[model samples]
Target chain A: MRFRYQMWTVFLAVACWGLGSVAQAAELTVSAAISLKEAFGEIAAQFEKGRPGDKINFNFAASGELSQQIERGAPVDVFASAALKQMNDLDKKGLLLAGTNQPFARNRLVVVVPKGEAKVTSFEQLSKVGRLTIGNPRTVPAGQYASEALTRAGIYNTLLASQKIVFSENVRQALAYVEDGNVDAGIVYATDARTSQKVSVGFPVPANYSEPVVYPIAVVKDSKQPDLARAFVTFVLSAQGQEILQSKGFLGANQ
Target chain B: MTDPWFSLRLSLAVATLATLVVGVLGTAAGYFLAKSRFWGKDFLDALFTLPLVLPPTVVGFYLLGLLGKRGWFGQVLFAWTGWEILFTFQAAVIAATVMAMPLMVKTARAAIESVDPAYERAAYTLGKGRWRTFFQVTLPLAWKGIAAGLVLSFARALGEFGATLMVAGNIPGKTQTMPLAIYQTTQTGEDTTALALVAILTVTSLAVLVATNRLAQGRPW
Candidate 1:
């Protein structure tokens, strides 16, 4: 019994130690799209190394989901979405600081398939594609772009009717469907496609077929760390930031 | 207002259906375990109660794998019927049922075990058949416990999130049940809508708990 008590006491001490570190960290909560996980991790490392006084806290999910959280009063310091609509909507609600909302980077919509299986080079080819996985358009910006591109290609209704849709909650999950070889193809942001070595991006959908893909960043109106948020935003739009984005296959905002 | 109402209706519908299926199956299984001796009875009991200890995500992921068109059983069914169950209302029902089954079974097994076996023996000696003895004597004595189990199942089914999302895919007006709605609203900063729905769920869950407690106390018995 004494041994068991000692074991439990040690276990409790370890658990409390784990939580204490998390509670004590100087966290800056930045809500971002799921696609930004890899990029943000690298950026956070550099940002922390330079600042040395803070850590970046990321709340990553579909842009729609993150936008809702901000509007509903989540204590997020920064909002970086894969699309402008959600950020713009938040701005319209006066939830973002003026002059804070700006396009920082861009990404393209791409058709992705399992590596070395088949190739798709044109938008029109999507109509004949089998097992197309897409994020739910109602909540994911990448899915909306895919919808617009498919509609412009005049294959939206055909693809819808084929009823082969596999809806993931976010672009990352949609990308997983393609990477895991579960679906023959998936529509995901070019940034998301770049994350996986198991899948190869087939081709970019023509820009004319859909609205320009842009990532927008904003400081929350009630941010406790607006300066830090702005710094992160500026870093994203800076030449160095653009280089990082470009290296990850993301388009520069200036383009 | 309209969105919350729709979400609430969907939640109730899903929960009710799930409770009905799980309550029946769980009670039957529980009764069998409590009273009958069978091969691997202990193992079967453990298997049935596994979901109680298992994480919801684990259950949800397995459901996703099993219900996807390319999955082992799903592929066969899809080929036979040209149908896909994943990301559909049917899949939501399945997820809720799986998540709620353990609660129903656990509650029901305790209730069944609490009954005096002397009652069953008495009925049998009076020449009552096994089925008749169970229906007339055992069931009536255990009605309160069964009702409590049903309510618990309903409450569990209503709060289901992870499994439902994994299986149903959150298609609005199709598979976006209440929990998914709340998640969507919260994710997008629709605080008013999210809080309102949460209030509704809280009230409903409280009512279920109170009602179950009253029944368990044999208030109406």
Candidate 2:
């Protein structure tokens, strides 16, 4: 009987502890583009430090994939996307909180090659490369941008015809392929290129090569904690947040 | 970054829960198929075996279409409960269960069929009902094979990657299993972390398979 009483007390204590934590912290699920991983990690840490009991969870993927998840009723509180098109589509579908859409950062597309490999230095010379990788244009914003740039360089069709193009699930995967020396060259964000030491930027895709890469953030309409979600959005657009992003090789929204 | 043990714990929980669900449903389906002879039984067997042969991504796509909020039954569920099933821990279990069911059913069906029906008939003649005969006679004879199937189902559930990723959306410390963590770490160029996770999964799976082989050989140890 004494052992049974002890076991009951322990069970009750464990149950209460579980309930206590759930009651204390407000968890915000932010689904963001893969490119925002490092910057957003820093910002979330700082944001949670200021609001002691609040927790932030991130779901990082391609912007298009994130949008599709939101559309399919994913329980996302906030979304930070790498491209305007994805955000615009979510807005048109009434999935975003009204007036919460704001562009917080910008980035440039660049061509990267394995370190110490300099066979192709210019965009026009990409045709001579053995294997070129980019994110899948269907679901990755970086891939769409890379495709537009390749089209402008007049080698997109030739690369396709010659089977030199390898599509990756996301920009990071494209970067990984190049870093692993599996591909001769890859097109990815300048910010992503900065994250790896095994790859070096061959050249930045010209500004006129594709539409500007702007990152927009917003709160989801189905968020249970709309105020907390809006606060996170505000924090991401703050000067401190912009500083973090810029330090990671991203351009300020105004730029 | 997620705590290294978080994915391991989550994968164990998801796999265990999925195995429990698959054990019950698959065993029932297997027994029914073994005992009953009906029209189009071959088609039914083929249907049950489809998921085992179909690419996991294709199965994931079909699950998404059937369970997404805009989907047929999902729309009704959302309208009544305002709850979405996608991207949750429950979604991981559902994905694992679907992927692991075929293994359990096939193994259980073969095991039950291999059992001598004479024992069941003797139990019936001794005044035992069908359920009692099954529990007392047939089950004792077939438990070994059924147990092997359960272990196989658990291993399959633990390693499920593509379907779970599609449905559960890879949120670290929430829905990211070990396989998803390895994929994410590899993409992020964290080769050491990926290698560690890969080693853990390979060792665990190999141990499970060895245990399964021992069980199949009728060794209790």
Candidate 3:
């Protein structure tokens, strides 16, 4: 009985090993910016449906952080960043293939206040508020954009004099401050504001007020699935992907 | 040597100050818990170190809620005087103090317990008051152990992550500490800066560990 049981176990192990080897799936790791999380989750599901035998893994964080990981020799296959600075840094380091980086979408910077608050109406009124929440411009791209826009409007120093400025770690957090009414108002991406019902846009910062808001996508050169990465990039550029982005309030590449 | 570099120095400074405050408070609490017994003493002992076991993000969240303007304590403070602790370097210190408290407390407690109470009693018989006994006799004898605890707490404070991130929110030169700086570098794809910060932390951690080991070993004689 013992001999028979041992043989049965061995046979089962061999069969499982054989099956595992034959049907093993390829894993694709993609690191993306925090803003792309909701959109990318939908894209990953679609990508999986088309490529049945592959699994997609994702790591989402601030674009700056994602780029730093790639630079530190992280094994990310695809990188989707909210800004071009980090991508260009990787490109300069030869970590990314030249010409593979493409601008995919654009976002707008807007001033937001609590949903029911009647204190502020126009961007100019933001100056009258006692507090304005923003992300730390040095580390967060959205904050940098807000600072640039405020600078261009030439109200940056004026706003500084009248209001307390709360610096958050990311634009989403700044949005949260506004949503929760923790600050009189906050500066965040328009798409980020869409996720919360507790905040409303006071006004869009004019395009000329700040540097262009563009999101770039690129395939890391060290990717194990270079072909798949390229395919994924193409999919993002396709009309279908553009539709997904546009539906979520992001401007498509052509826009 | 740039903005990040300046941020790095500021972070180190904050962590150092945080370590000092936590060390003093934790050592006093640890000594009391280890050497004396009173009502609810055990519970109080555990409370001082609870932050160690609790999730840092949770600590940060509650801390934010507590320090925010609408929170009870903050509201009272604001009502009494126009003062705000949230989103400031002072808040960073509070987070670091809470996060590193357990290390110092646990370490100091162990050292205090390891010293035989008979020695303390002998000093008491030599006409020392409880406070004097502790400061003059018990403290000197246990100084090495306390030093070890201090170093351990300092190292723990230097690497504080989630709580600092949550409460301090990574404001460069204001709330950013070493771990936050490293995290920011990695996020931004500034590999050189990240790598440099990592090396610096590694060396500092090793030096602290060495000092901790020597202190823990007690006097050779």
Candidate 4:
């Protein structure tokens, strides 16, 4: 009836509003790791406020996943990965603009347990007591770092043989497993662990605990706005961007 | 090629197993509802119809709560067998089955209801037993509808994503299905593989749907 037509009209109006695009000087498409969501979001806001004409669009996901998107020609201007291996591979493939791929930030890996857990306080105790959730080492750099650290601690194979470990698609999921109380513990970046209130860090691995977790940023060779890409990368390495990242529990790439 | 094929094989395997389960259970449940008038029938109908309306993620999240290791049923099973079902192929089948069952049930119930009660009364007067009358007379008349519903159910099962991901955890070479593979690849901007997987899924579902339509039409082909 008349009411139904009005409802349809309202729905179409909302849909059109959603589909409308904003006019801007330039849109800088940046692909960053999911673990960098908070830091990058804040930095993007700061950048936007400073230059109202330029807009920043971020595609956040796992570093490996982001790199693969960049590899296959996603419309991304800047690529930032949580792990160096993906950036190194992209650079080797000549996908990055020369001299633009630089380490912007670093992260530390930590083991977290469900909030208010009673057992398994220390890193070594994890092998004896709780199911451990880890990212797949084959695809996730955080997983590799975790496995290496466990190997150094001499418990990787033991946990494997005991079938005490499960794997997730990414670091955030590992944290989720712990947060949901589905797994006894999870290995994730310190920044990821911090994002979840339902989980708490049980222990932080040493800085040189395993492979270094340096985040590398680069301008894509296919970038249409190479100058804009360079500017964004420079901003990420700038004192302001570094301060924002540090405030979000990330370490500087150098220190 | 083989890499994507693994996901395709897993998707087909999961959908086939799920369709088989829902096909039998849905048809049986549909027939029961059509023939019987019992307490809480309206409530049961609403419950069975819910999956069709709710978001897949909501269904998936509920499945996790019910079947996860710490869940009531899973906790008991874990205590008895030291086995948990989450993050495995079985969980994927379960997710697909849960998602596809509602469509089958709804379609099947309507099909069975459309059959005349006079045929059952006639079979009974001819000394045919209940089960025999149902199987011989009522079922044969209504089977095309059920088959169509089952095929549609299979199509839904193949596209299942959120619930499957919630329970099965998308472990490659294990629980990863074509839909999840497409999602993973597309997320990473691996479009060639993703597009290939998308085409495979589309063609298979479309073929099944066309066949369903043909069967429904009683076409000679």
Instruction: Please name the candidate that would achieve the greatest TM-score relative to the true structure.
Output: 2
User: Positional deviation of B148 in candidate 4, in angstroms?
Assistant: 11
> Which clashing pairs does model 2 show?
none
Tens digit per residue, CA lDDT, model 1, A47-146: 7787878877665556765666566454578888988998999999999989899888888888999999788877667667788988787877778888
lDDT value, residue A216 of candidate 2 = 93
List model 3 lDDT by residue over B106-125, tens digit each. 88888888888898899889
Model 4 segments more than 4 A misplaced:
A1-18, A21-25, A119-121, B1-221
Q: Residue A119 deviation, candidate 3, in Å?
A: 6.4
Q: Candidates' lDDT values, in order?
A: 0.75, 0.83, 0.73, 0.78
Question: What TM-score do all the candidates reach, one by one?
Answer: 0.55, 0.88, 0.54, 0.54
As for model 3, its CA RMSD to the true structure in angstroms is 18.9
Q: What is the interface RMSD of each candidate, in Å?
A: 18.9, 6.8, 22.8, 18.4
- Per-candidate Cα RMSD to the true structure, in Å, reads 17.3, 4.9, 18.9, 17.3
Per-prediction tally of clashes: 11, 0, 6, 1
Residue A126's C-alpha lDDT in candidate 2?
82
Superposition error at B30 for model 4 (Å): 27
lDDT of 3 by residue, A189-237 (tens): 8888777677888888887888888999999987768989888888888
What lDDT tens digits, residue by residue, belong to model 2 across residues B3-30? 5567776776777778779989998889
Worst 10 residues of 3 chain A by lDDT: A16-25
